[model samples]
Target chain A: MLLQQIINGLTLGATYALIALGYTMVYGIIQLINFAHGDIYMIGAFIGVAAVALFHQNFFLTLATAMLACVVLGVTIERVAYRPLRRAPRLNLLITTIGVSIFLETFMTVLKGPQPTGFPTVLENVTLRVGTLEFSSIQLVILLVSVALMVGLQFIVKYTKIGKAMRAASEDYDTASLMGININRVISFTFAIGSALAAAGGVLVGIYFNSVSPYMGVTAGLKAFVAAVLGGIGNIPGAMLGGLLLGLAEVFGVAAGFSTYKDAIAFTLLIVILLVRPTGLLGRPIQRKV
Target chain B: MEQWLSSVIDPYYQQVLMLVGIYIIAALGLNLITGLCGQLTFGHAAFLSIGAYTAAILTRDFHLPFILSLVLGGLMAALFGILLGIPVLRLTGDYLGIATLGFGEIVRVAFTNMKITGGAIGLAAIPRASNLINVTFFVILAVAAVVLLENSRFGRALKAIREDEIAAEAMGINAMWYKIQAFGIGCFLAGISGGFYAHLLQYLNPNDFGFLKSFEILNFVVLGGLGSIPGTIVGTTVLTLAPEFLRFVQEYRMMIYGLLLVLMMIFRPHGLLGGVNFRRLLRRRKQKATALSS
Candidate 1:
């Protein structure tokens, strides 16, 4: 029973990690929280469903199509909504993101009514057993795909030349720009990558949960943000760890019959982690200038 | 003035005007924290809820007088504000915002589970104690209080802290104490506003005071101009009245807000600044032209 719960947690955790990555990366590069990122994930889910249900596409193709569409959307949001406020106060940028978030949610609501639509089941659900723990093929696929995307992200962020530029810009935006790094391109690239990952997570979650709605982004986005903060706001590895731990804790809390307070669990952990550690588990402690 | 306001305006607009007054109080409080003190919090609604519950319970169960109960409710919220501020005020910027958000969510969950608070079904039948007269009185009183507070020594200290905390500390200011006080004052206003909300609506539900409500208040402050009193009032009035003026406005309210935020931030980040204050601008421009000519 414990093993089954752990597996379930891991599957859930993987999707959270995908969305969390977008938050951490954006925060890392430009000190903005990218509040609209969650809605991007919601849009991705909608697209994934459209590809499968409307166009009758296969699973992998649907995922890719959703991801590609989101890449364009994310980059456009950055270029239009965020870039102009680049030199403005951090507060202005944050407000702009909130506006974008409200815009995207309401826009989607206008497009597709407020109700949640059933996700198309493109992949057949087959029971897969590993030892005594029984899980579905969909769970296995979600886990495998999430890990693969994360690994690919790590490779792109670490090994690529643009990744180098990304790191420099994250360290200091003005300094990186002064060094002829073309920080605009780097920031846009970062948004593109982050949005793609969130998009992938959205599709996987849609497939797992079998439903997608305009408002789904609000809760999942908040939890994923909590996971990002749990691991430390700007730390990539920390986001992954935080996502898994939050998922496990929530699953176990639900298992323990605190189902009514399920939403509270992530927030409680967030508050405790923020108050106690402030820096997160894998993050470097901030050096306060005396 | 109260009689004239009631007799002249239609019932629908009277309710709208009353809601606008309630929000003005809350937004002013939030403006102090976010705009003036530079401490951004997205959980101001949590304080509002605390006051609402306190007022509802006091008036309903204890059968206390409404005015006295309202003041007590405000005090109760201020107490929680200080408590929440002790640990949370240490963090700055976005981290502080998130922590406050967490606090808000915790408060909401607690309220939803408590029996005395009516669990999730909500508490109905508080005395219909609020009307235009009391709400207007409170609005004028709150505005005067904020203006006085801002022009005082404490207000300067808060401004200094907002500009640069370390510098404020270096100048013989007890930064932590002032921050806590500012946070307390902000919550007190939120509490008073919550009291008004409870009495005006005559019902209290935990879900009504969610993060979205907090965001709406924050938007009001930002859309007006952070730290500007007249600006915030103008911003709130404009936003609150937008839905009433246009057809199908309720449906597209959030959509327009989103668009307005983006366009405003990009083109005019300073918000209205109370729309240029034409007289003051004309005087300034005249002064500039004369000086140049001379």
Candidate 2:
């Protein structure tokens, strides 16, 4: 029973970790929370829904198209909402993101109506049984895909030239610019990659839950954001760890009899963690420079 | 013309005016926290709920006097604000925003789960205590109070903190104390507004004070210049009345509202009347720019 719950927690955690990567990457690069990232996740789910409805059982093609759509949407949001506020105070950027989030949510509501739609089941009958342990093939696939993506991302960051550029930019945008890295392109690319990951997470979630709604992103995005903060806002690996821990805590909390207290438990944990270590578990402590 | 005005404008228009007055007061209160104190509070609605419920319960169950209930509600909200601020105000920016956001959700959830608060069914038939006279009077009173607060030494300290907290602290300002004061005052005003809303609407529900309402008030402060008194009033009025005026576009109402916000942020990043104070602008204009010496 414990093993089953752990597996359940791991699967849920993997999804959160994927989503948190998007948030952490953006925050790491720009120091902005990108409040609209959750809405972007929502949009990704909608795009996935459309792709599934169109492609009908062609899982790979549907996933590709949804990711592509997310990339475009993410880049556009950056250009339209964030780009203009490049030099503005952080508060303006925050408000703009909030406005953008509200706009997306309201627009989605108007377009799709306020109802949870049935996600098309492409892996409905695929169950794996391994000697007293039962698992859905879809869950296994989601776990593998998420881990693979994270590993691929790690490699890209460590090995590729663009990855090096991103690292330099994140370390110090001005210094990176002095070294001839196109800051604009690097930032845009960062948003694109983060958004693509969120899109992928959205697709996996839609499949796993067998349902998607306009507001699904709100809570999930919030939880993922909490995970990122718990892991340290700007730390990529920390975000992953945070996501997995939050997912496990939530799953176990629900599984252990207090289903309704899951949210409270998660938030309480966040507050306690923050109180104890404001910089987060993997984050560097930032001291006030006199 | 006079007869036509009285016949068409007297009934619902008066009610709209009353609501606008109440919301303007509420938005002004929020402006104190987000604008002046630089606290990104996504939980103003929680305070509003506290006020509304306090008044509703007091007036209904305990048979308290209406004015007493209103004052008690405001006090209760202020108490809660102080409590929430102590542990949480140590955090800044997005951290503060998220914690307050969580606090708001917790308040809503608690309200929903509590039996005396009527659970999810909502408290109904709240006595209507808000009329045009009382709303308008309180609007003036609230506006005057905020203006006075803003111009006072405390207000300047709050502004200093907003501009740069470290600098403010370096200058010997008690950062935590001022923050608690700002939060308490903001919640007090929000409670007052909530009391009025409950009495005006004759109903109170946990769902009614959700994050969306908090965001709506935040929108007012953001769209209006932060820290500008007139801006808050103008932001509240324009935002509240725009949907009513654009009622013809019912299907596309929210879309247009969203578009307007985006456009506003893009074009006037400081807000519609940001930076320059209304009084200061008029005084400067009256001085005639030194007649353009060139």
Candidate 3:
């Protein structure tokens, strides 16, 4: 029973890690929280559904379509909403993100009426039993895909020249810009990649849950953000650890019969973690320079 | 005369006006924290709920008088504000915002699960104690009190803290105490507004006071102009009344607000009025006109 629950937790945690990567990456590059990232995930789910249900596409095609669409949307939002506020106060930027978040949520609500739509069952649900623990094919697929994606992301960030540029930009924006890096392109590229990951997470979540709604982004986004913060706001690996821990904690909380308070658990843990270690488990403590 | 006035203006308009007044009170309190003190609060609606539930529960189950319940509600909210401030105020910028947001969510979830607070069912049939007269009286009183507070020594200390925390602390100012007090006062007014809100609606649901509501109030302060009292009033009025006027696009109104918030921040982060003190502007204009005539 415990093993089964742990598997369940891992499956849930993998999706959170995917979403958290986008958050951490965005925060790493630009100090903005990218509040709209979660909504991009929501839009990704809708796009995935559209790909399968409307166009009768396969699962990979659907995922690619959603990721591509979110990339466009993410880039546009950055250009239209955020680019102008590049030099504005951090507070203004934060508020703008909230506004953008609300805009996407409401716009989606207007497009698709406020109802939870069932995602197409593109993948078969075949459960495999290992001892007393049973694992579904969908769960296995989600876990495998997420792990592959994270590894791919790590490769892109560490091995590629663009990745080197991204690292330099994140370390110090002004200094990186001074070194002739295309700051604008790098920032846009960051948004694009982060958004694509969120979209991928969204589709996986839709398949796992079998439903998507306009308001789904709000809670999921917050939870993923909590995951990001738990791992330390701007740390990549911390986000993964935080996501898994959060997912396990939530499952255990439900297992302990606090089902209604599941949402509260992430937030409470966030507060506790923040108070105990402002810098997340994997995150290096920031040196405050006078 | 009262009967004639009632006949001329529908009670619906009165209700709208009262709601506007209640929001004005709440926004004013937020203005102090977010606007003047430069603290970013994303869970102010939590304080609103605390006050509303406190007042509603006291009046309904305990059978207390409405005014007494209202006062107690504000005090309770103030107490919670101080409690939240102690640990939370240490964090700055976005972290502080997230912590408050978490606090708000926790409060909301707690309200949803707790049996005494009516759980998901929420408190209903609250006493119809708040009306236009009392709401208006409170609005004026609250505004006057805030204006006075802004000119006082405590207000100067808060302003100093807002400008430069380290500098303010270096200059013999107890920044933490002032921040806590500012938070307490801000929540107190929010509680009072919530008291009025509960009584006005005569129904209290935890969902009604959430992060969205907090954001709405924050928008009022931002749209008006940070640190400008009159600007908050103007911002709240324009935002609240514009919706009623554009009732045709009522569904799209929130969408418009979302777009406007982004655009407003991008185009004019200082706000619509650019954080200008209107009273000072008018006096300066008058002096210029006099000098030109001479």
Candidate 4:
């Protein structure tokens, strides 16, 4: 029973990590929370549902389409809403992102009519037993896809030229620009990749839960954001670790019959972690220059 | 004249005014914290909820009078503000915002699950002791206090902190105490506003005081002009009244609000007033006209 719950927790955590990667990446580069990132995840889920229901696409096609759609949307948002305010106060940028998030949520709500739709079963649910542990095919698929994506992300960040530019830009944007790197392209690429990951996570979540809604992103986004903060807001690997830890904590909290307070657990844990280690686990301590 | 005015004004208009008055109080409080103190709080509605519930329970169960319950409710919220501020206030900027957001959610969840708060069903049939006149009186009082405080020595200390916290600390200003006091005062007003809100609506739902509502109050502060009292009042009045006039676009109201927020931040980060004194605008325009004529 414990093993089954752990597996379930890991599956849930994988999706959160995917979403958290987007948050951490954006914060890493720009220091903006990208409040609308979660909404992008929601839109991804809706797009997936539409691709399956309307176009009769298969699971892989739906995932790809959703990811593509979100990439375009994410880039557009960065270009139009956030890019102009790049030189503005951090608070202004933050508030603008909240506005962007609100717009995305309301726009989606208007289009989708605010009803939770069950994801059409594109893949059959088949349970597998391996040495006293029972798991479903969907769980395995989610795990494999998430891990593959994370690995791909790791490779790109570690080896790719664009990834190098991203690291340079994040380290010192002014210096990066002075060094003749196109800051705009780097930022846009970051949004594209981060948004794609979130989209994939959204589709996986929709499939795993078999339900999707406009507001689903709010809670998931917040939880994943907490995970990001837990591991360290701007650290990619920290976001992944935080997501998994948060997921396990929540599952254990539920298993202990504190289901009603499940949402509170993530927040409470975040508060405790913040109070204890303001930089978060795995996060480097910030040094004040002056 | 009084008879004619009373006859001319309808209950609907009164209700709208009452709501505007309530929001004005809440927004004014937020202005002190977010505007003057330079702290961005995303969970102010939590304080409002505390006050509303306290007042409702006091009146319903303890048989307290409306005024007494309202004051006590505000005090209760102020207490929570101090408590929440003690730990979280030390964190700066976005971290503070997240902590407050967490605090807000925790308060909401506690309210939702607790039996006395009536769970998610919410507490209904709250006494309808709140009205336009009393709400107006409180609004006037709050405005007076804020304006007076803003110009006073304490207010200057707050502005000094807002300008440069490190510098303010170097100047021997107790930054932590000021922050907590500002937070407490801001929450006190939110609580009082919530008291009026509950009695006026005669319903108290934990859902009403979520992050969205907090965002709405922040909108009023930002849209008006940070640290500007008149701006907050005007912002709240215009926003509250805008929905009524734009009833045609009620469904798209939030979307429009979102767009406006983005646009406002981009074009006028200082807000509509641009932190320019309104009185100076007319004079500047006149001076420009005079120069053009010359």
Candidate 5:
């Protein structure tokens, strides 16, 4: 029973970690929270539902389409909402992001009619068992895909040319520009990649839960954001760790006979972590620019 | 025609006026924090909820007088705002935004789970004490207070901080104290607004005070320009009435609202009024002409 719950916790943690990666990476590079990222995630699920219903495709194809759609959406949001305000006050950019988020959420609510729809049964029904531990095959798939994505992200950030440019731009945009790197491209690419990851996470969640809704992203996005903060806002690896820890906390919080307190526990942990180590578990302490 | 006009238009106009008055009170409080202090709080709705709930409980359960309960509710919200602000005010910019967001969410969830808050079923049918007279009176009082604060020495200090915090501190301003004072005062106004909202709606629910409502209040501030009190009032009135005016676009109301916000940011990023005080603008123009002649 304990093992089953641990597996459940880990599965939940992996989804959060994936979403957290997107939020952390964007914040790390641009120092903007990308409030619209969650809405992009929601759009991805809606697109996934449409793809499956319209194309009559298999799960993998639908997932890919959803991710691709989200990448475009993410880039568009950045170009439209954020790029202009790049030179404006930080507060203006923050407000713009909120506007974009509200726009997307309300748009979806209006279009989708504020109701949740269940995903097709193909992915939802596939379950796998290993001895006494019974688990859905989709859960296993979600875990593997999330781990792979994180590993791939780590490699890209550490080794690739674009990754190197991303790091440079994050460290200092002006310096990166001086070094002949296109700051615009790097920022756009960061948003694109983060959005793609969010889309994938959204699809997985929709499949795992067998339901999708316009407002689902609000709570999930908030939790993932909290995870990002718990791990340290601008630290990628910290976001992953924080996501997992938050997931575990929620799962065990429910398992320990306080199901209703799950969200409260997650927030309490966030406050405690922030108070103890404002920089987070794997984050570098930011000194005041002064 | 005249008899019909009195019966039909008067009640609708009265309701609209009442709503505008209540929103003005709410937006004015937000202006103190976001406009003057330069703190972007995404949790003002939470404070409003606290005030509304407090007043509701006091009136319903404790049998307190309506006016006194309303004041008490505002006080409770201000107390919570101070408590939440103490640890988090040390952080600035986006960190502060996130911390406040979390605090807002915590308040929401707590309200959802608690039995006294009516647990998502919400609190209904207390009393509809916020008629046109009461709303109008409170609105005038709030406007006067905000206008007075804007012209006072303390208000100048707030503007100085908003212009540049480090510079203000260099000029011997007590930065932390001023920020806290602004936050506490903002909460007080937010509480009053919430109290009024409760009486107006005669229904209080946790769902009504979510992040979206916070964003709605924020929309008014941003659309009005940060520090302009009159602009805040105008912005709230226009935005609130826009949907009603465009009732044909009911299905796309939110989408249009979103587009309006985006366009406003792109075109008139300083807001419609751009923080210009009507009276001050006239004076400044006169002063400029005098200087030019001199």
Candidate 6:
């Protein structure tokens, strides 16, 4: 029973980690919490649903379409909404993101209506038994896809030229710009990668839960954001660890019959972790701007 | 006065005014903390909920007088404010925001699960004890107090901290203590506003005070001009009245608000009154008058 719950927790945690990666990366580079990132994730799920329902695409094709579309949408949003306010106060940029989030959610609602759409059964749910433990095939698929994407991300960040630029910009943006790196291109690339990850996470969530809604991103975004903060807001590895721990904690809390407080569990962890280690488990100490 | 108000104006308008006044009071508190103090909080509505619930429970169960319950409710929220403030002292900027957001969610969930707070169904049968006069009196009191605080040595210290925290510390200001005090006072005002809000509705629900409501209050503070009293009032009044004016486009209200927020940030992050600097503007006018006369 415990093992089953742990698998379920890992499946959920994987998606959160995907989303948290976006948050941590954006915060790492620009120092702005992209409130609209969750909405982008929501849009990805809708695209996935549309792909399956309208175009009759298979699972991989649908997931790929969602991710590709999100990359475009994410880049567009940065170019139009965020680029002009590059020199404004961080608070103003934050508010602009909130505004964009609100607009996207409502616009989607207006277009698709407010009901949650059921994800088509692209893959059959088949339970597997190994040594007195039972797990579903969907869990395995989610785990596999998540691992593949995260590994790809790790490679890009560790080895790619743009990844090196990203590291430099996150370290010191002004110096990076002075080093002849195009800051705009780097920021746009960061958004593109983050949005793709979030889209993949969104699709995986849709596949796992078999449901997609316009408002699904609101709570999930918040929790993923918490996950990012828990790992240390700008630390990619920290976000991953934080997401997994949060998932396990929530699953166990439910197992202990505290399902009603499921939402609270993430927030409680957020407050406790923030109070104990404001820099997060893996984050460097913050240098307050003069 | 009640009789006269009723004779002179419709009860509907009076109720609208009451709500506006309550929001003004709430926004004033937010202005003090987020606008003036430069602490970006995302859970202010949580404080309001604490006050509303406390006042509602007191009036419904203890048979306490309306004023007493209202004051006690404010105190309760202020107590929570202080407690929340103590641990988050080391955190600044976005970290503090997320922490407050977490705190807000925790408070909401706690209220949702607690039987005494009526669970998710929320407390009902709250006496409709507060009236327009009560709301008016509190609004006037809150505004007066904030104005006084803004001009005092304490207010100057807060502005100094907002402008340059390191510099403020170098100047011998105790930044930590002042932050907690500002947070306490801000929450206190939100509590009283919640107290009024509860009696006005005579019903309470956990869902009423959500993250969106917090955003709505933030919109008011930002739109009016951060740290500016007239700006806060203008922002609240305009935003409060915007929905009514746009009732024809009810569904588009949120979309428009979202667009406006983005545009406002891009074009005028200082807000409508943020750069107005009323005292300086008035002083310039006075100087012009003297120059013309001479």
Q: After superposing candidate 4, which stretches have Cα over 4 Å from the reference?
A: A54-57, B1-6, B276-294
DockQ, every prediction: 0.65, 0.46, 0.69, 0.66, 0.54, 0.74
- Estimate the Cα RMSD of every predicted model relative to the unseen true structure: 3.0, 3.1, 1.8, 2.7, 3.0, 1.8
* Deviating ranges (above 4 Å) for candidate 2: B1-10, B278-294
- What's the TM-score of each model vs. the native? 0.94, 0.93, 0.96, 0.95, 0.93, 0.96
Q: List the pairs of residues colliding in candidate 6.
A: A231-A238
Please list all clashing residue pairs in model 3, or write none if there are none: A231-A238
Cα-based lDDT for every prediction: 0.89, 0.85, 0.88, 0.89, 0.83, 0.90
Flag the better candidate by TM-score, 1 or 4: 4
Per-model chain A TM: 0.98, 0.97, 0.97, 0.97, 0.96, 0.97
Q: Residue A5 in candidate 5 has what lDDT?
A: 85
Q: Report how closely model 6 matches the true complex, as a DockQ value.
A: 0.74
Candidate 4 is scored at a TM of: 0.95
Q: Candidate 2, residues A109-169: lDDT per residue as tens digits?
A: 9899989998887666577888778888888988998899899889988999998998888
Write one digit per residue (lDDT tens) for candidate 5, span B5-105.
44766877777777888888889999999888888788889999999999888887888888898889889988998888888777777667777877787
Model 2 CA lDDT for position A63: 78
Instruction: Residues A14-118, candidate 3: write the lDDT tens digits.
Output: 999999999999899888988888899999999999999765648898999999999999999999999999888777787788899888898989999899999
For model 3, the local distance difference test gives 0.88
Position A194, candidate 6: lDDT: 95
- Alpha-carbon shift of residue A67 in model 5 (angstroms): 0.8
Give fnat (model 6): 0.78
Instruction: Give the winner by DockQ: 2 or 6.
Output: 6
> Worst ten-residue run, lDDT, model 5 chain A?
A119-128
Specify the poorest-scoring 10-residue window by lDDT in model 2 chain B.
B1-10
lDDT of 3 at A54: 60
Which prediction has more favorable TM-score, 2 or 6? 6
Model 6 regions more than 4 Å off:
A288-290, B288-294
Q: State the number of backbone clashes in model 2.
A: 0
- The sequence of per-residue lDDT tens digits that candidate 4 reaches over residues A48-141 is 9888875675888989999999999999999999999999877778889889988988888888778888988878899999999999999999
